[model samples]
Target: MQLDLTTFILEVLNFLVLVWLLKRFLYKPVLSVLDARQQRIQGEMRKAAVLQEDAARLKQQYEARLADWNTEREIAKQSLEQELARERDTGMKAIQQSLADEEAKNRVRAASAIATREAELVRNATSGAYRNAAAMLRRMASPAMTLAILNILLDDLASLSEKRQEELHKAAHPENVTTMEVVAAHALEESAQRKLGDAVAKVCGKPLQATFKTDTSLIAGLRISLGESVLHANLADELGYFRSQDKNV
Candidate 1:
């Protein structure tokens, strides 16, 4: 068990050589492999992070497009609704105007029909009244009444102004008619005729021929016809004038 300095030194030299070789051959290679694996891992993690960021950007773009589409659809729906409402209001106004026009036409037609009916009734009543009055007047003629009316006619001729009397006398010219016709509702007595001729000559300023006729339609009066002019003092003529007034009413 004596210490061997040479052998111990050799053993120490061999151990140092072995440590250097292991460091140069095994530890360096292993450390290099570990560094490459760590670099690949880091590169993969960086690529994943970039892909996730791209996916998030795409998702945001899709969501924004969807929101825009929804807003456009809502706007289109509101526009369509407003258009439909305007159309409905226009249709309603047209219908109301048509109804109002039809109602006005109906009212006008009704008023026209009513007015026509009233006019027809008035015409019928007027005709009936006129005929009845004429019949009653014809039934009341008398010779005494006729004589009284002739006397009144002679008095009226006498009372005429000088100008009217001259006009009447001129109308009974002897060239157109040699005689003036005197019509009565009844025949006159000879004495009455002579008296009437004298009165007629006094009004005419010259004596003229005379003719007489009996027409009961006069009711009770005298009518002296010379030419176009006729001196009428008759109930029938008065009744006709009154009938004209009534018809006008």
Candidate 2:
């Protein structure tokens, strides 16, 4: 509590010296260490920022590549689907065309078969008709029928056209034709033969020699032969003609 100037002054001087020693050794070294640590921390922070920027750029690039891959996959899928559809259509059309062609061929074959069968039936029917006609005519043949047909033949020769008469005249010329033969299915009376000879001579425009014969195979009417020319008015010849026509059918 008493005033001690000299002692206070000595204490103050010792305290100042201690403070100077501390600043020179401890304080200076501690400040240097703190500054170095601060510098190192700042360098580490800058490195971290650079790493973050690189990571962001890499992520963006990965995202862009993924989008492009997705687009390409979609396009490939659509193209494959279109190609499959086109192939299916082509196959279906080919099958349909083949089926149509087969159907047409079958129809043609059926039509041909039907036509052949019909033609055969017609031929059979016509043959039967001709046979019946021949049989009926054979049953009706007789001497009386022959005489009647002979009269008709005489009438036809008498009424022949001018052109036909000329043909007969030329064919039965006296020098070329030695004899004009007349054959009948039945025997003829002398008066009938003379009348027939006179009628033939008149048609030939000159007198002609006559010869007569009989054959029952004529069935009816007469046959007149002059050289290579022969004329028949007979049921047998008629029936034979019908048979030939049937065969043609």
TM-score of each: 0.53, 0.54
Model 1: residues >4 Å from true position, as ranges? Answer: 1-116, 161-167, 245-249
What is candidate 1's lDDT per residue for 162-230, written digit by digit as tens?
A: 888888778765575567798887899998888888887787666778899988777888788766567
Question: Candidate 1, which ten residues in sequence have the lowest lDDT sum?
Answer: 171-180
Tell me the whole-model lDDT of each prediction, alpha carbons only: 0.81, 0.81
Report the number of clashing residue pairs per model: 0, 0
> Candidate 2: what lDDT?
0.81
Error of 2 at 54 (Å): 14
- For candidate 2, the per-residue lDDT at 186 reads 81
Window of ten residues with lowest summed lDDT in model 2: 125-134
Clash number for model 1? 0
